[model samples]
Target: MKLALFLVLLTLSMSTRAVLDDCTCLVDCKCKKSLRPGQYYCASPDVDTDSQAIRNCNRDTGTVEVPCYAAPNVSCGGLPYNATQCIFTESRPCTFVNGKRYNYYLAVGLSLFLGMLGVDRFYLGYPAIGLMKLCTMGFFLIGHLLDFLLILLQVVGPADQTGYYAPFYGPLVSRVLVNGTDPFIESSSSCTL
Candidate 1:
């Protein structure tokens, strides 16, 4: 009788234990594929390259349907949230859509330090332009200046094999920098494949 009573108590105690599974899907927008249809991946201001959008695959449609941007504020209370707070500054891992990504800092560094050598173009897979810049000293230095401006303007990001521009600092890297960790890694000895 005592053994059975002890077993019952053990089972009851185990069941009573609290399990916290607070999956904040809306507070932080992230893209994730869902097996079930009608599960929409909604991102505020439209989905961008980065995965900073709500990934709640089960948000009900109609009156109960909550938007990624609107969910956080309404859930947090009646107070309005700052627009900047919604921004996330973490870069998505590479291999995101055919391994297309470029380092923003590297392009800027090359533009500043090696534009005359056309190293930036070479790095960006523009071998012809790189060669021209190399031979003509960055198009007699005019192209070099223009290239620098373009790089800062985000007009000169590396292209994927498909020739689509792959910018390093996109929606993914728009998060607030905390403790020096962001999309563009600064202090890594080896590159992430």
Candidate 2:
């Protein structure tokens, strides 16, 4: 019983004399010399507006305080000064195709070159007439001559047939003088204005 009592007394004395080596100091401790004059003191019991201001402050953070008042003179950096609001503009889909019938003059030129052989007429979607022209040697060469005359009239016109010729007569005249392949033969339809 005496030994038990002694052990209990020894344990109590050891615990009482134990050193707290790992204890940490509070950041707002009055002991520090570098503390700011208006530094936030979290442990203070005074809860007021200035303390609330410290709580609401986010200066160190990236958050920005947008001004409630709109400045009339203020302009977006690179945009026009008169432009009030910024809007994204997109292109409307294209609806019109230009010069869809650019190949009509080409067909007329082809008819002149191969009309005697009916090749031109055949390519022009007039197979029956082409066959007849072919069988008759371009109508005993008379039909070929008439076809040439018609093409010529259509091109330059008889000096008096002014309205019969189209505006593209210049290219037709040039093509005739050059007399190359019929460009419109491969096309499904001759282009016309």
Q: Which candidate leads the pack in TM-score?
A: 1
Backbone clash numbers for all candidates listed: 7, 1
Each model's lDDT comes to 0.47, 0.38
Tens digit of lDDT per residue, candidate 1, span 142-166? 9999999887776666655322223
Whole-model lDDT, candidate 2? 0.38
* Per-model C-alpha RMSD: 17.4, 38.4
Show model 1 residue runs off by greater than 4 Å: 1-100, 161-193
Candidate 2, poorest ten consecutive residues by summed lDDT: 88-97
